[model samples]
Target: MPKFTGYVSDHTKFIEELKSKTPGMEERQQEGRSLLWDKLPISLDEEARTRESRLRQNAYPYQNKF
Candidate 1:
């Protein structure tokens, strides 16, 4: 009988292969994440300005006021 080694899941194996094939993928992913999600905290004044700059939408927009 052989000593049981650590088991690697199929998904993990695939990811490892993908990383080997594409270098700098992790850096690009980080850059994309920063562009879409990583953001600076906004000040209270900025939040208030953003809230104040929006126009209210009417309910049942398709129906005419007439």
Candidate 2:
């Protein structure tokens, strides 16, 4: 076997250490990611409305477009 450097070789042990230090760590991580990053699809009508709104911004707002 090669000499062990400071870097970790055992990934499972590392995860165990994290789980032990923080209770409900994995479950909370899943929930937080779902709340912030997970994308649910909007309704087709909502999507069409958004697309229609985008078509209205022809000029930059700084030009005082009415």
Best by lDDT: 1
Q: Stretches of candidate 2 above 4 Å error?
A: 1-8, 55-66
Clashing pairs in 2: none
Taking the tens digit of each residue's C-alpha lDDT, what string does model 1 give over 1-66?
997579888999999999999999999999999999999999999999999999888998788998
**lDDT assessment of candidate 1:** 0.96
Candidate 1 lDDT for residue 6 = 91
- What TM-score against the true fold does each predicted structure earn? 0.84, 0.54
Residues 1-66, candidate 2: write the lDDT tens digits. 898667675887788898999999899999999999998989999999898888465466568645
lDDT value, residue 57 of candidate 2: 52
- Output the worst ten-in-a-row residue range by lDDT, candidate 2: 57-66
For all candidates in order, the CA lDDT equals: 0.96, 0.85
